[model samples]
Target: MSGLETEKELAEEFVLAAFEKDDRRTIRRMLTSDALVYTPNVPGPGLDVDEFESQILDAFHGAFPDLSIAVESLVSEGATVVCRFTMTGTHEGVFRGIEPSGETVLVTGVVELRLTGSGIADVWQTTDSLALLEQIAAYDHENVRGERGS
Candidate 1:
Protein backbone atom coordinates (compact mmCIF):
# COMPACT_ATOMS: atom_id res chain seq x y z
CA MET A 1 0.00 0.00 0.00
CA SER A 2 1.11 3.55 -0.63
CA GLY A 3 1.58 5.99 2.27
CA LEU A 4 -1.75 7.63 1.60
CA GLU A 5 -3.52 4.29 1.47
CA THR A 6 -1.99 3.32 4.79
CA GLU A 7 -3.15 6.55 6.36
CA LYS A 8 -6.67 5.99 5.05
CA GLU A 9 -6.73 2.51 6.50
CA LEU A 10 -5.53 3.83 9.82
CA ALA A 11 -8.22 6.47 9.78
CA GLU A 12 -10.86 3.85 9.09
CA GLU A 13 -9.57 1.71 11.93
CA PHE A 14 -9.62 4.68 14.27
CA VAL A 15 -13.24 5.49 13.48
CA LEU A 16 -14.35 1.88 13.86
CA ALA A 17 -12.55 1.60 17.14
CA ALA A 18 -13.91 4.83 18.51
CA PHE A 19 -17.53 4.65 17.37
CA GLU A 20 -18.35 1.09 16.35
CA LYS A 21 -16.57 -0.81 19.09
CA ASP A 22 -16.57 2.07 21.59
CA ASP A 23 -13.11 0.97 22.61
CA ARG A 24 -11.71 3.87 24.53
CA ARG A 25 -8.37 2.17 25.09
CA THR A 26 -7.70 1.64 21.41
CA ILE A 27 -8.94 5.13 20.62
CA ARG A 28 -6.55 6.58 23.16
CA ARG A 29 -3.66 4.59 21.71
CA MET A 30 -4.49 5.82 18.22
CA LEU A 31 -4.38 9.49 19.27
CA THR A 32 -1.48 11.66 20.23
CA SER A 33 -1.50 12.61 23.91
CA ASP A 34 -2.09 16.27 23.11
CA ALA A 35 -4.29 15.82 20.09
CA LEU A 36 -6.57 18.77 19.31
CA VAL A 37 -10.28 18.11 18.81
CA TYR A 38 -12.90 20.51 17.46
CA THR A 39 -16.62 19.93 17.15
CA PRO A 40 -19.63 22.19 16.63
CA ASN A 41 -21.24 20.87 19.79
CA VAL A 42 -18.52 22.18 22.01
CA PRO A 43 -17.98 25.88 22.58
CA GLY A 44 -14.94 28.01 23.35
CA PRO A 45 -11.51 26.50 22.70
CA GLY A 46 -10.94 23.12 21.12
CA LEU A 47 -10.63 20.07 23.26
CA ASP A 48 -7.59 17.95 24.07
CA VAL A 49 -7.54 14.16 23.95
CA ASP A 50 -8.68 13.82 27.55
CA GLU A 51 -11.51 16.31 27.13
CA PHE A 52 -12.61 14.69 23.91
CA GLU A 53 -12.82 11.33 25.59
CA SER A 54 -14.87 12.66 28.46
CA GLN A 55 -17.05 15.31 26.84
CA ILE A 56 -17.61 13.74 23.44
CA LEU A 57 -17.08 10.01 23.77
CA ASP A 58 -18.36 9.43 27.24
CA ALA A 59 -21.30 11.76 26.80
CA PHE A 60 -22.39 10.11 23.57
CA HIS A 61 -22.16 6.69 25.13
CA GLY A 62 -24.29 7.86 27.96
CA ALA A 63 -26.94 9.45 25.74
CA PHE A 64 -26.97 6.72 23.16
CA PRO A 65 -25.94 3.47 24.73
CA ASP A 66 -26.30 1.59 21.46
CA LEU A 67 -24.90 4.24 19.20
CA SER A 68 -23.46 3.13 15.88
CA ILE A 69 -21.59 5.03 13.18
CA ALA A 70 -21.75 3.88 9.57
CA VAL A 71 -19.02 5.32 7.41
CA GLU A 72 -20.44 6.58 4.14
CA SER A 73 -17.02 7.41 2.70
CA LEU A 74 -13.44 8.09 3.63
CA VAL A 75 -10.98 10.12 1.60
CA SER A 76 -7.38 10.87 2.35
CA GLU A 77 -4.64 13.13 0.99
CA GLY A 78 -1.31 13.79 2.56
CA ALA A 79 -1.81 13.82 6.34
CA THR A 80 -5.49 14.68 6.26
CA VAL A 81 -8.35 12.18 6.20
CA VAL A 82 -12.02 13.12 5.85
CA CYS A 83 -14.75 10.73 6.85
CA ARG A 84 -18.44 11.13 6.13
CA PHE A 85 -20.64 9.05 8.38
CA THR A 86 -24.20 8.42 9.52
CA MET A 87 -24.85 7.85 13.19
CA THR A 88 -27.92 6.02 14.53
CA GLY A 89 -29.02 5.59 18.07
CA THR A 90 -31.85 5.90 20.56
CA HIS A 91 -31.99 8.70 23.08
CA GLU A 92 -31.97 6.91 26.43
CA GLY A 93 -30.10 9.41 28.57
CA VAL A 94 -29.78 13.14 28.91
CA PHE A 95 -27.98 14.91 26.07
CA ARG A 96 -27.33 18.63 26.09
CA GLY A 97 -29.85 19.13 28.89
CA ILE A 98 -32.63 17.48 26.90
CA GLU A 99 -34.52 14.73 28.65
CA PRO A 100 -34.64 11.27 27.17
CA SER A 101 -37.46 10.83 24.67
CA GLY A 102 -36.73 7.22 23.72
CA GLU A 103 -36.59 8.44 20.14
CA THR A 104 -34.26 7.00 17.57
CA VAL A 105 -32.12 9.57 15.82
CA LEU A 106 -30.15 9.48 12.58
CA VAL A 107 -27.46 12.10 12.36
CA THR A 108 -24.99 12.63 9.53
CA GLY A 109 -21.59 14.16 10.06
CA VAL A 110 -18.10 14.66 8.64
CA VAL A 111 -14.79 14.60 10.42
CA GLU A 112 -11.39 15.70 9.20
CA LEU A 113 -8.41 14.14 10.86
CA ARG A 114 -4.77 15.13 10.63
CA LEU A 115 -2.40 12.30 11.35
CA THR A 116 1.25 12.15 12.35
CA GLY A 117 3.74 9.34 12.92
CA SER A 118 2.74 9.52 16.57
CA GLY A 119 -0.95 8.88 15.67
CA ILE A 120 -3.86 11.26 15.04
CA ALA A 121 -2.84 14.82 15.89
CA ASP A 122 -5.89 16.94 15.17
CA VAL A 123 -9.60 16.52 14.41
CA TRP A 124 -12.38 18.81 13.18
CA GLN A 125 -15.93 17.50 13.28
CA THR A 126 -19.31 18.81 12.13
CA THR A 127 -22.69 17.18 12.61
CA ASP A 128 -26.35 17.90 11.91
CA SER A 129 -27.42 19.07 15.34
CA LEU A 130 -30.78 20.34 14.12
CA ALA A 131 -31.69 16.94 12.77
CA LEU A 132 -30.82 15.32 16.06
CA LEU A 133 -32.89 17.83 18.00
CA GLU A 134 -35.86 17.39 15.69
CA GLN A 135 -35.68 13.66 16.02
CA ILE A 136 -35.84 14.00 19.79
CA ALA A 137 -38.66 16.58 19.68
CA ALA A 138 -36.58 19.27 21.29
CA TYR A 139 -38.51 22.04 19.59
CA ASP A 140 -41.74 23.48 20.94
CA HIS A 141 -44.01 23.45 17.91
CA GLU A 142 -47.15 24.35 19.83
CA ASN A 143 -45.46 27.37 21.34
CA VAL A 144 -44.33 28.51 17.93
CA ARG A 145 -47.87 28.16 16.56
CA GLY A 146 -49.26 30.12 19.51
CA GLU A 147 -46.76 32.95 18.95
CA ARG A 148 -47.78 33.05 15.30
CA GLY A 149 -51.53 33.07 16.27
CA SER A 150 -52.19 30.03 14.23
Candidate 2:
Protein backbone atom coordinates (compact mmCIF):
# COMPACT_ATOMS: atom_id res chain seq x y z
CA MET A 1 0.00 0.00 0.00
CA SER A 2 0.94 3.67 -0.33
CA GLY A 3 2.46 5.71 2.47
CA LEU A 4 -0.77 7.55 3.19
CA GLU A 5 -2.63 4.27 3.27
CA THR A 6 -0.08 2.88 5.65
CA GLU A 7 -0.44 5.87 7.95
CA LYS A 8 -4.19 5.50 7.97
CA GLU A 9 -3.89 1.84 8.83
CA LEU A 10 -1.45 2.63 11.59
CA ALA A 11 -3.81 5.18 13.03
CA GLU A 12 -6.58 2.60 13.16
CA GLU A 13 -4.37 0.09 14.85
CA PHE A 14 -3.21 2.68 17.36
CA VAL A 15 -6.78 3.49 18.31
CA LEU A 16 -7.70 -0.14 18.63
CA ALA A 17 -4.72 -0.99 20.75
CA ALA A 18 -4.91 2.04 23.00
CA PHE A 19 -8.68 2.39 23.49
CA GLU A 20 -10.19 -1.01 22.80
CA LYS A 21 -7.60 -3.68 23.35
CA ASP A 22 -5.62 -1.69 25.94
CA ASP A 23 -2.39 -2.91 24.46
CA ARG A 24 0.23 -0.53 25.75
CA ARG A 25 3.10 -2.18 23.94
CA THR A 26 1.52 -1.70 20.54
CA ILE A 27 0.72 1.91 21.43
CA ARG A 28 4.30 2.57 22.43
CA ARG A 29 5.50 1.14 19.15
CA MET A 30 3.19 3.36 17.15
CA LEU A 31 4.32 6.67 18.67
CA THR A 32 7.65 8.37 18.13
CA SER A 33 9.84 9.31 21.07
CA ASP A 34 9.06 12.99 20.64
CA ALA A 35 5.44 12.61 19.65
CA LEU A 36 3.08 15.34 20.83
CA VAL A 37 -0.67 15.08 21.37
CA TYR A 38 -3.25 17.75 22.04
CA THR A 39 -6.68 17.05 23.44
CA PRO A 40 -9.52 19.45 24.04
CA ASN A 41 -10.02 18.55 27.69
CA VAL A 42 -6.41 18.72 28.76
CA PRO A 43 -4.83 21.84 30.17
CA GLY A 44 -1.40 23.32 29.41
CA PRO A 45 0.34 23.13 26.02
CA GLY A 46 -0.10 19.40 25.24
CA LEU A 47 1.15 15.96 26.11
CA ASP A 48 4.27 14.18 25.03
CA VAL A 49 4.33 10.50 24.15
CA ASP A 50 4.87 9.40 27.75
CA GLU A 51 2.14 11.67 29.10
CA PHE A 52 -0.25 10.51 26.39
CA GLU A 53 0.33 6.91 27.37
CA SER A 54 0.12 7.53 31.09
CA GLN A 55 -2.60 10.14 31.34
CA ILE A 56 -4.73 9.20 28.36
CA LEU A 57 -4.05 5.57 27.53
CA ASP A 58 -3.53 4.23 31.01
CA ALA A 59 -6.06 6.40 32.77
CA PHE A 60 -8.88 5.78 30.29
CA HIS A 61 -8.17 2.09 30.05
CA GLY A 62 -8.20 1.79 33.80
CA ALA A 63 -11.33 3.86 34.27
CA PHE A 64 -13.23 2.13 31.49
CA PRO A 65 -11.98 -1.38 31.16
CA ASP A 66 -14.65 -2.25 28.60
CA LEU A 67 -14.04 0.84 26.48
CA SER A 68 -14.56 0.48 22.78
CA ILE A 69 -13.78 2.89 19.96
CA ALA A 70 -15.26 2.48 16.52
CA VAL A 71 -13.69 4.38 13.67
CA GLU A 72 -16.52 5.84 11.66
CA SER A 73 -14.45 7.33 8.85
CA LEU A 74 -10.87 8.11 7.90
CA VAL A 75 -9.19 10.26 5.31
CA SER A 76 -5.61 11.07 4.57
CA GLU A 77 -3.53 13.65 2.73
CA GLY A 78 0.24 13.67 2.58
CA ALA A 79 1.53 12.52 5.98
CA THR A 80 -1.62 13.32 7.92
CA VAL A 81 -4.58 11.07 8.66
CA VAL A 82 -7.87 12.29 10.08
CA CYS A 83 -10.08 9.79 11.83
CA ARG A 84 -13.59 10.21 13.18
CA PHE A 85 -14.55 7.73 15.87
CA THR A 86 -17.13 6.98 18.51
CA MET A 87 -16.10 5.90 21.98
CA THR A 88 -18.35 4.06 24.42
CA GLY A 89 -17.61 2.86 27.90
CA THR A 90 -18.97 2.47 31.41
CA HIS A 91 -17.67 4.73 34.15
CA GLU A 92 -16.69 1.90 36.47
CA GLY A 93 -13.49 3.37 37.85
CA VAL A 94 -12.58 6.75 39.20
CA PHE A 95 -11.87 9.21 36.40
CA ARG A 96 -10.77 12.81 36.53
CA GLY A 97 -11.46 13.00 40.29
CA ILE A 98 -14.99 11.70 39.88
CA GLU A 99 -16.19 8.59 41.63
CA PRO A 100 -17.45 5.65 39.66
CA SER A 101 -20.92 6.53 38.40
CA GLY A 102 -21.49 3.26 36.58
CA GLU A 103 -23.06 5.23 33.78
CA THR A 104 -22.35 4.36 30.20
CA VAL A 105 -21.20 7.22 28.00
CA LEU A 106 -20.87 7.37 24.27
CA VAL A 107 -19.03 10.22 22.68
CA THR A 108 -17.90 11.09 19.18
CA GLY A 109 -14.52 12.60 18.40
CA VAL A 110 -12.04 13.33 15.68
CA VAL A 111 -8.28 12.78 15.71
CA GLU A 112 -5.69 14.02 13.27
CA LEU A 113 -2.37 12.21 13.17
CA ARG A 114 0.84 13.33 11.58
CA LEU A 115 3.14 10.48 10.75
CA THR A 116 6.85 10.46 10.12
CA GLY A 117 9.22 7.76 8.92
CA SER A 118 9.83 6.69 12.51
CA GLY A 119 6.23 6.74 13.74
CA ILE A 120 3.49 9.15 14.71
CA ALA A 121 4.89 12.67 14.99
CA ASP A 122 1.92 14.56 16.41
CA VAL A 123 -1.77 14.20 17.13
CA TRP A 124 -4.65 16.61 17.66
CA GLN A 125 -7.96 15.41 19.05
CA THR A 126 -11.34 17.00 19.70
CA THR A 127 -13.95 15.05 21.63
CA ASP A 128 -17.54 15.73 22.64
CA SER A 129 -16.74 16.48 26.26
CA LEU A 130 -19.74 18.72 26.74
CA ALA A 131 -22.13 15.92 25.98
CA LEU A 132 -20.27 13.54 28.26
CA LEU A 133 -20.22 16.02 31.16
CA GLU A 134 -23.92 16.71 30.69
CA GLN A 135 -24.75 13.06 30.96
CA ILE A 136 -22.65 12.61 34.05
CA ALA A 137 -24.20 15.64 35.71
CA ALA A 138 -27.66 14.38 34.93
CA TYR A 139 -26.85 11.06 36.44
CA ASP A 140 -25.57 12.71 39.59
CA HIS A 141 -28.64 14.90 39.87
CA GLU A 142 -30.91 11.94 39.49
CA ASN A 143 -29.11 10.10 42.25
CA VAL A 144 -29.27 13.11 44.53
CA ARG A 145 -33.02 13.52 44.00
CA GLY A 146 -33.55 9.85 44.73
CA GLU A 147 -31.51 10.04 47.91
CA ARG A 148 -33.47 13.08 49.13
CA GLY A 149 -36.74 11.29 48.55
CA SER A 150 -35.67 8.21 50.47
Candidate 3:
Protein backbone atom coordinates (compact mmCIF):
# COMPACT_ATOMS: atom_id res chain seq x y z
CA MET A 1 0.00 0.00 0.00
CA SER A 2 1.09 3.56 -0.68
CA GLY A 3 1.53 6.22 1.99
CA LEU A 4 -1.97 7.55 1.38
CA GLU A 5 -3.52 4.09 1.65
CA THR A 6 -1.64 3.36 4.83
CA GLU A 7 -2.73 6.69 6.27
CA LYS A 8 -6.31 5.98 5.34
CA GLU A 9 -6.15 2.61 7.04
CA LEU A 10 -4.72 4.22 10.16
CA ALA A 11 -7.47 6.80 10.14
CA GLU A 12 -10.10 4.09 9.83
CA GLU A 13 -8.58 2.16 12.67
CA PHE A 14 -8.56 5.29 14.78
CA VAL A 15 -12.21 5.96 14.14
CA LEU A 16 -13.18 2.34 14.70
CA ALA A 17 -11.24 2.19 17.93
CA ALA A 18 -12.99 5.35 18.98
CA PHE A 19 -16.58 4.64 18.01
CA GLU A 20 -16.74 0.85 17.85
CA LYS A 21 -14.10 -0.37 20.22
CA ASP A 22 -14.38 2.58 22.66
CA ASP A 23 -10.69 2.32 23.28
CA ARG A 24 -9.59 5.93 23.79
CA ARG A 25 -6.03 4.95 24.50
CA THR A 26 -5.71 3.09 21.22
CA ILE A 27 -6.78 6.17 19.31
CA ARG A 28 -4.71 8.42 21.54
CA ARG A 29 -1.53 6.51 20.77
CA MET A 30 -2.22 6.86 17.05
CA LEU A 31 -2.35 10.67 17.05
CA THR A 32 0.55 13.05 16.74
CA SER A 33 1.73 14.75 19.93
CA ASP A 34 1.14 18.18 18.43
CA ALA A 35 -2.21 17.44 16.86
CA LEU A 36 -4.87 20.15 16.76
CA VAL A 37 -8.64 19.83 16.85
CA TYR A 38 -10.57 22.72 15.30
CA THR A 39 -14.20 22.28 16.02
CA PRO A 40 -16.76 25.08 16.07
CA ASN A 41 -18.61 23.67 19.02
CA VAL A 42 -15.62 23.33 21.33
CA PRO A 43 -14.47 26.53 23.02
CA GLY A 44 -10.80 26.81 22.19
CA PRO A 45 -8.40 28.03 19.58
CA GLY A 46 -7.78 24.35 19.25
CA LEU A 47 -7.70 21.36 21.56
CA ASP A 48 -4.64 19.14 21.69
CA VAL A 49 -5.19 15.60 20.44
CA ASP A 50 -4.94 14.18 23.94
CA GLU A 51 -7.36 16.73 25.42
CA PHE A 52 -9.64 16.13 22.48
CA GLU A 53 -9.59 12.43 23.22
CA SER A 54 -10.19 12.91 26.92
CA GLN A 55 -12.97 15.46 26.61
CA ILE A 56 -14.86 14.00 23.68
CA LEU A 57 -13.91 10.42 22.92
CA ASP A 58 -15.49 8.77 25.94
CA ALA A 59 -18.42 11.16 26.38
CA PHE A 60 -19.52 10.50 22.84
CA HIS A 61 -18.62 6.85 23.08
CA GLY A 62 -20.33 6.55 26.45
CA ALA A 63 -23.37 8.33 25.13
CA PHE A 64 -23.44 6.38 21.97
CA PRO A 65 -21.60 3.24 22.87
CA ASP A 66 -22.61 1.72 19.58
CA LEU A 67 -21.52 4.77 17.64
CA SER A 68 -20.02 3.84 14.29
CA ILE A 69 -18.58 5.82 11.43
CA ALA A 70 -18.48 4.62 7.84
CA VAL A 71 -16.26 6.09 5.20
CA GLU A 72 -18.72 6.77 2.43
CA SER A 73 -16.00 7.83 0.00
CA LEU A 74 -12.40 9.00 -0.17
CA VAL A 75 -9.87 10.79 -2.34
CA SER A 76 -6.25 10.00 -1.72
CA GLU A 77 -3.20 11.88 -2.92
CA GLY A 78 0.31 11.29 -1.69
CA ALA A 79 0.11 11.51 2.11
CA THR A 80 -3.29 13.17 2.26
CA VAL A 81 -6.61 11.37 2.43
CA VAL A 82 -9.89 13.29 2.20
CA CYS A 83 -12.66 11.16 3.59
CA ARG A 84 -16.41 11.67 3.36
CA PHE A 85 -18.34 9.72 5.94
CA THR A 86 -21.41 9.41 8.13
CA MET A 87 -21.43 9.10 11.95
CA THR A 88 -24.40 7.46 13.62
CA GLY A 89 -25.09 7.22 17.33
CA THR A 90 -27.73 7.43 20.03
CA HIS A 91 -27.86 9.95 22.89
CA GLU A 92 -27.37 7.91 26.03
CA GLY A 93 -25.53 10.60 28.02
CA VAL A 94 -25.25 14.36 28.35
CA PHE A 95 -23.71 16.07 25.31
CA ARG A 96 -22.46 19.58 25.95
CA GLY A 97 -24.58 21.05 28.78
CA ILE A 98 -27.73 19.30 27.68
CA GLU A 99 -29.03 16.16 29.28
CA PRO A 100 -29.43 13.06 27.20
CA SER A 101 -32.70 12.96 25.37
CA GLY A 102 -32.26 9.40 24.24
CA GLU A 103 -32.28 10.58 20.66
CA THR A 104 -30.31 9.02 17.86
CA VAL A 105 -28.25 11.37 15.76
CA LEU A 106 -26.71 10.57 12.41
CA VAL A 107 -24.40 13.27 11.14
CA THR A 108 -22.17 13.53 8.09
CA GLY A 109 -18.89 15.29 7.52
CA VAL A 110 -15.65 15.39 5.56
CA VAL A 111 -12.22 14.98 7.10
CA GLU A 112 -8.82 15.51 5.55
CA LEU A 113 -6.18 13.44 7.26
CA ARG A 114 -2.55 14.19 6.53
CA LEU A 115 0.02 11.58 7.41
CA THR A 116 3.66 11.85 8.41
CA GLY A 117 6.32 9.21 8.87
CA SER A 118 5.23 8.53 12.43
CA GLY A 119 1.44 8.54 12.10
CA ILE A 120 -1.23 11.10 11.24
CA ALA A 121 0.29 14.55 10.96
CA ASP A 122 -2.89 16.59 11.27
CA VAL A 123 -6.61 16.38 10.59
CA TRP A 124 -8.82 19.21 9.30
CA GLN A 125 -12.51 18.47 9.50
CA THR A 126 -16.09 19.75 9.96
CA THR A 127 -19.56 18.34 10.37
CA ASP A 128 -23.18 19.45 10.66
CA SER A 129 -22.89 20.93 14.14
CA LEU A 130 -26.32 22.51 14.17
CA ALA A 131 -27.94 19.31 13.06
CA LEU A 132 -26.15 17.39 15.75
CA LEU A 133 -27.18 19.90 18.42
CA GLU A 134 -30.77 19.50 17.33
CA GLN A 135 -30.50 15.73 17.28
CA ILE A 136 -29.24 15.63 20.85
CA ALA A 137 -32.18 17.72 22.10
CA ALA A 138 -29.80 20.54 22.85
CA TYR A 139 -31.66 23.16 20.85
CA ASP A 140 -34.25 24.99 22.87
CA HIS A 141 -37.37 24.72 20.75
CA GLU A 142 -39.36 26.23 23.56
CA ASN A 143 -37.09 29.24 23.57
CA VAL A 144 -37.82 29.81 19.93
CA ARG A 145 -41.49 29.57 20.69
CA GLY A 146 -41.02 31.79 23.72
CA GLU A 147 -39.35 34.40 21.57
CA ARG A 148 -42.38 34.23 19.32
CA GLY A 149 -44.55 34.82 22.42
CA SER A 150 -46.55 31.60 22.22
Candidate 4:
Protein backbone atom coordinates (compact mmCIF):
# COMPACT_ATOMS: atom_id res chain seq x y z
CA MET A 1 0.00 0.00 0.00
CA SER A 2 1.07 3.61 -0.48
CA GLY A 3 2.28 5.68 2.46
CA LEU A 4 -0.98 7.57 2.54
CA GLU A 5 -2.99 4.39 2.49
CA THR A 6 -0.88 2.91 5.24
CA GLU A 7 -1.42 5.93 7.45
CA LYS A 8 -5.10 6.10 6.76
CA GLU A 9 -5.51 2.40 7.32
CA LEU A 10 -3.78 2.58 10.70
CA ALA A 11 -5.82 5.57 11.75
CA GLU A 12 -9.02 3.77 10.79
CA GLU A 13 -7.84 0.67 12.51
CA PHE A 14 -7.32 2.63 15.70
CA VAL A 15 -10.91 3.75 16.14
CA LEU A 16 -12.45 0.55 14.78
CA ALA A 17 -10.48 -1.60 17.12
CA ALA A 18 -11.35 0.59 20.06
CA PHE A 19 -15.03 0.38 19.22
CA GLU A 20 -15.10 -3.33 18.53
CA LYS A 21 -13.24 -4.17 21.70
CA ASP A 22 -14.60 -1.42 23.92
CA ASP A 23 -11.30 -1.47 25.76
CA ARG A 24 -8.42 0.90 26.38
CA ARG A 25 -5.87 -1.75 25.42
CA THR A 26 -7.02 -1.52 21.82
CA ILE A 27 -6.39 2.22 21.91
CA ARG A 28 -2.95 1.71 23.37
CA ARG A 29 -2.04 -0.78 20.69
CA MET A 30 -2.89 1.77 18.01
CA LEU A 31 -0.65 4.57 19.25
CA THR A 32 2.98 5.38 18.68
CA SER A 33 5.53 5.70 21.47
CA ASP A 34 4.92 9.43 21.69
CA ALA A 35 1.32 10.18 20.79
CA LEU A 36 -0.60 13.38 21.40
CA VAL A 37 -4.32 13.36 22.02
CA TYR A 38 -6.58 16.40 21.99
CA THR A 39 -10.19 16.37 23.07
CA PRO A 40 -12.75 19.00 23.99
CA ASN A 41 -14.30 17.06 26.85
CA VAL A 42 -10.95 16.98 28.56
CA PRO A 43 -9.74 19.88 30.67
CA GLY A 44 -6.33 21.58 30.33
CA PRO A 45 -4.11 21.40 27.25
CA GLY A 46 -4.21 17.95 25.61
CA LEU A 47 -2.32 14.96 27.00
CA ASP A 48 0.61 12.78 26.13
CA VAL A 49 0.82 9.06 25.33
CA ASP A 50 -0.21 7.42 28.57
CA GLU A 51 -2.54 10.09 29.93
CA PHE A 52 -4.41 10.77 26.71
CA GLU A 53 -5.23 7.17 25.97
CA SER A 54 -6.27 6.55 29.57
CA GLN A 55 -8.57 9.56 29.79
CA ILE A 56 -10.73 8.77 26.74
CA LEU A 57 -11.03 5.12 27.56
CA ASP A 58 -12.17 6.10 31.03
CA ALA A 59 -14.52 8.73 29.64
CA PHE A 60 -16.09 6.35 27.15
CA HIS A 61 -16.48 3.61 29.69
CA GLY A 62 -18.03 6.06 32.09
CA ALA A 63 -20.25 7.92 29.63
CA PHE A 64 -21.57 4.85 27.88
CA PRO A 65 -21.78 1.38 29.23
CA ASP A 66 -21.42 0.28 25.64
CA LEU A 67 -19.78 2.98 23.55
CA SER A 68 -18.70 2.51 19.97
CA ILE A 69 -17.74 4.71 17.05
CA ALA A 70 -18.58 4.52 13.35
CA VAL A 71 -16.49 6.10 10.66
CA GLU A 72 -18.57 8.47 8.55
CA SER A 73 -15.85 10.00 6.37
CA LEU A 74 -12.13 9.91 5.84
CA VAL A 75 -9.52 11.95 3.99
CA SER A 76 -5.80 11.52 3.90
CA GLU A 77 -2.72 13.45 2.86
CA GLY A 78 0.57 11.56 3.09
CA ALA A 79 0.65 10.52 6.75
CA THR A 80 -2.29 12.39 8.19
CA VAL A 81 -5.86 11.16 8.38
CA VAL A 82 -8.80 13.51 8.72
CA CYS A 83 -11.86 11.65 9.89
CA ARG A 84 -15.46 12.45 10.61
CA PHE A 85 -17.50 9.92 12.56
CA THR A 86 -20.38 9.21 14.91
CA MET A 87 -20.09 7.73 18.36
CA THR A 88 -23.16 5.87 19.53
CA GLY A 89 -23.73 4.62 23.03
CA THR A 90 -26.28 4.05 25.72
CA HIS A 91 -25.80 6.23 28.77
CA GLU A 92 -25.82 3.81 31.65
CA GLY A 93 -23.38 5.72 33.81
CA VAL A 94 -22.83 9.30 34.92
CA PHE A 95 -21.20 11.64 32.39
CA ARG A 96 -20.32 15.31 32.36
CA GLY A 97 -21.89 15.89 35.80
CA ILE A 98 -25.20 14.37 34.71
CA GLU A 99 -26.70 11.29 36.23
CA PRO A 100 -27.43 8.24 34.16
CA SER A 101 -30.66 8.77 32.24
CA GLY A 102 -30.47 5.50 30.36
CA GLU A 103 -30.56 7.28 27.00
CA THR A 104 -28.83 6.50 23.77
CA VAL A 105 -26.71 9.18 22.17
CA LEU A 106 -24.94 9.52 18.86
CA VAL A 107 -22.38 12.32 18.77
CA THR A 108 -20.47 13.34 15.66
CA GLY A 109 -16.97 14.75 15.47
CA VAL A 110 -14.05 15.64 13.22
CA VAL A 111 -10.69 14.14 14.09
CA GLU A 112 -7.28 14.81 12.59
CA LEU A 113 -4.60 12.19 13.12
CA ARG A 114 -0.98 11.91 12.24
CA LEU A 115 0.59 8.52 11.62
CA THR A 116 4.12 7.53 12.41
CA GLY A 117 5.37 4.23 11.02
CA SER A 118 1.82 3.08 10.44
CA GLY A 119 0.70 3.84 14.00
CA ILE A 120 -1.23 6.84 15.24
CA ALA A 121 1.23 9.56 16.20
CA ASP A 122 -1.19 12.27 17.26
CA VAL A 123 -4.88 13.12 17.22
CA TRP A 124 -6.94 16.30 17.54
CA GLN A 125 -10.67 15.81 17.87
CA THR A 126 -13.69 18.09 18.27
CA THR A 127 -17.11 16.60 18.96
CA ASP A 128 -20.68 17.76 19.52
CA SER A 129 -21.39 16.60 23.05
CA LEU A 130 -24.13 19.21 23.35
CA ALA A 131 -26.27 17.22 20.94
CA LEU A 132 -25.55 14.10 22.91
CA LEU A 133 -26.55 15.83 26.13
CA GLU A 134 -29.73 17.08 24.53
CA GLN A 135 -30.59 13.62 23.30
CA ILE A 136 -29.88 12.14 26.71
CA ALA A 137 -31.83 14.83 28.48
CA ALA A 138 -28.82 15.79 30.52
CA TYR A 139 -30.22 19.28 30.91
CA ASP A 140 -33.87 18.48 31.57
CA HIS A 141 -34.22 20.99 34.37
CA GLU A 142 -36.92 22.86 32.41
CA ASN A 143 -38.92 19.71 31.92
CA VAL A 144 -38.52 18.86 35.59
CA ARG A 145 -39.65 22.34 36.58
CA GLY A 146 -42.62 22.20 34.21
CA GLU A 147 -43.72 18.89 35.68
CA ARG A 148 -43.56 20.39 39.16
CA GLY A 149 -45.56 23.43 37.91
CA SER A 150 -43.00 25.75 39.46
Best by TM-score: 1
| Candidate ranking (lDDT, best to worst) | 1, 2, 4, 3
Clashes of 4: 0
Better of 1 and 2 by lDDT: 1
TM-score of each: 0.88, 0.85, 0.80, 0.80
Clashing pairs for predicted structure model 1, backbone only: none
Among the numbered candidates, top lDDT falls to: 1
- Report the Cα lDDT for candidate 4: 0.76
Which structure is stronger by lDDT: 1 or 4?
1
Q: Encode model 4's per-residue lDDT on 1-150: one tens digit a residue.
A: 886676666767776665535556777777777788888888887788677656776666777868778888889987779988898889888776778888888888788888776478788977787787788774675786799996
Worst 10 residues of 1 by lDDT: 136-145
Residue 101 error for model 4, in Å? 0.6
lDDT of 4 at 27: 76
Candidate 3 regions exceeding 4 Å error are: 138-150
Q: Which 10 residues in a row give candidate 2 its minimum summed lDDT?
A: 133-142
Candidate 3 residue pairs in clash (backbone atoms < 3 Å): none
Instruction: Report the C-alpha lDDT of model 3 over 14-129, residue by residue, as the tens digit.
Output: 66675567776786677777877665656777778776676667567767776878878777788777878799988887776678788889998777777777776677667787
Candidate 3 lDDT score relative to the true structure: 0.74
